[model samples]
Target: MRHRIKNSLALVGSIAVQTFRGDAPAGAAMPRFMERLKAIGRAQDVLTGDGEVSAQLRELVERALEPHRGGDCRRFRIEGPDLRLPEASATALAMALHELATNALKYGALSRDDGCVVVRWWVQADGSGGELRIEWREQGGPPVVSPARRGFGSGLVERALAAELHGRCVIAFEPAGVVCEIRAPLPRVAG
Candidate 1:
């Protein structure tokens, strides 16, 4: 428990340092940073709830996307079996989901009237808890083109989340839309 709190604080501190050191305009950076912090806080709420160090994967996804969803049920297709994630994996995955949903709203599926997103996950059981597989797919959006350089959100989702959860994240910008695939071991211990 002590280690979980320490590590979580360390990760949050790292995020704060990186956020302020970036080149974003002063007006834009603070709001974005606060949103990220809020996303983290939502994940922490699940992690610390009722003496359970694990959280429902579905609930985490919903909370992460809550700000961007705006009560539009038709734009999202979130489905998966009930699976519980360890604290570190839950936090990292939630942050990654929040970034993806924000980007989708601003520039991808959620930006268009005809577009939609689907989020699905499943678990593969193992002796060391299990392995989690999640997919985020966008459809009917504008033609996709890969960015010339990875941005902060990309770095956070692909690199930081991977390190924090000891996992792998791959994002593909297909002409049809954007797809993000995440796979991680379900370690009971906090990373």
Candidate 2:
């Protein structure tokens, strides 16, 4: 109980620190920061629940994208099997997904009325062990171009997948839209 409390406090402190460290005006930054904290809280809720040792992948994805769903949930298509992910991996993946959704809403498919996004995932067996591959594809948006430099969202997505879940993340800006793919070892990500 004490350990959990300590960890929770630490997480809150970290969020606060990150929130204030940004240069954006407080009026604009506060909302985005709060949204991110809420995302983390939802992931924590899933991780701490006693009903299951692992979290459902679909639930995590939904939670990550929920804030951005707006009134056009139909514009997003999410499909995957009932896969379970370990607490750490689930949290990391949730954060990554949030970044993707935020970017989409800001500049990609979700920004346009006719644009759409699709998220898909599957498990595959390799010589050593199985792997999970998640793909995020956006279409029907304005022409896409790679960013001149990586931003905080891109860095967070790449680093969290690599460091926290031992995964590889790739982001591509095709002329049509953007594509983000994440591949991670099943044993490590589904512990």
Candidate 3:
């Protein structure tokens, strides 16, 4: 049930981005896509849930779509040893992370001279497999509350990118800042 719900959310989020963001879809009707997104939104109140799972899922979506408020700084950094993984997955993750980081520089925590952003990643062996850990932190910004509505960006980061990598995201809205963390199994790389 939970997997299905999350998948549905991702689907809606993907189509919403395509429908609204000027990205062209091969054959789906735009109106139909919008309806699907609305239905998914109604089916789950992603914002109301609590606990680690809920918090992580919400954070995944939130970080994927960090919005830029006015006067955001434009500086940040990324840290992580390069892992051998599918190029597509790496690209997608990088793209999503870049979007959030860029937005933070423009409007979120990194927008001011006093603000900064830090992104870190690492690979840890777990049991029979390996897991990847990635974190994004916003150092300074105006006070922010969890938004009442989930926008296209959040939906994409949480649902789409996460599904692609078979991972979960965790976002936290803190009194002093914002933080996003993602954990996914490291995929095998073909020779």
Candidate 4:
């Protein structure tokens, strides 16, 4: 029980630190911070649910993006096999997905009525072991250009994937939109 409480507190602390690190106006930042906090809470609920040792990847993705799916749910597409992820990996990946969805809403494809986002994932056999690859692609929004400096979201995605899931994350700002790809060893992601 103590361990669970500690973990929950740590998660909240991390969220608070990350959410307030920006210089955005309070009105703008408050809603985003609340959304992110809710995302983390949902992921924690999944992790702590009884009788389920692992979480469904699809479910995690949906939970992460739930807050962003407004009247036009059709703007987002998620395609992936019914893979199971360990608790830690699920939490990390869920957070990363939340960040991506937030960015999409703020600056990428989801920002426009005509824009859309496609999220896909697959598992493949590698020389060492099986690997999982996930991609987030946006289209029909404003043209994307690489940022002059990495922001908190980019750094969080890269570091979390690398440290927690032993994955490599690449963020590409293409002419059309933003694309994020993550590749991780299956064993690590599956725990």
The backbone clash count of each candidate, in order, is 0, 0, 8, 0
lDDT of 3: 0.57
State the displacement of the C-alpha of residue 63, model 2, in Å, after optimal TM-score superposition: 1.9
Q: Is candidate 2 or candidate 4 better by TM-score?
A: 4
TM-score-wise, the better of 3 and 4 is 4
Give the distance in Å from residue 113's predicted Cα in candidate 1 to where it truly belongs.
2.4
Instruction: Give the Cα lDDT of each candidate.
Output: 0.84, 0.80, 0.57, 0.81
Best by lDDT: 1
Which 10-residue span in candidate 3 carries the lowest summed lDDT? 50-59
* Candidate 4 global lDDT: 0.81
Tens-place lDDT per residue, model 3, 98-156, is 45655466557766677777777788888958898878888877665676775555655
Instruction: Give the per-residue lDDT digits (tens) of candidate 1, residues 1-191.
Output: 79887977887887777777767776777888788889999998887775688888888888888777777878888999977787877888898888898889888999998799999988878888888778999998888889998887898898977887788988999889899988788656543
TM-score of each: 0.89, 0.87, 0.60, 0.88
Q: Candidates sorted by lDDT, descending order?
A: 1, 4, 2, 3
TM-score ranking, best first: 1, 4, 2, 3
Q: Mark the 10 consecutive residues where model 1 has the least summed lDDT.
A: 182-191
Candidate 4, 111-190: lDDT as tens digits: 99999999999998879878989999999999888889987788878886667778799888999999999998884433
lDDT of 4 at 186: 86
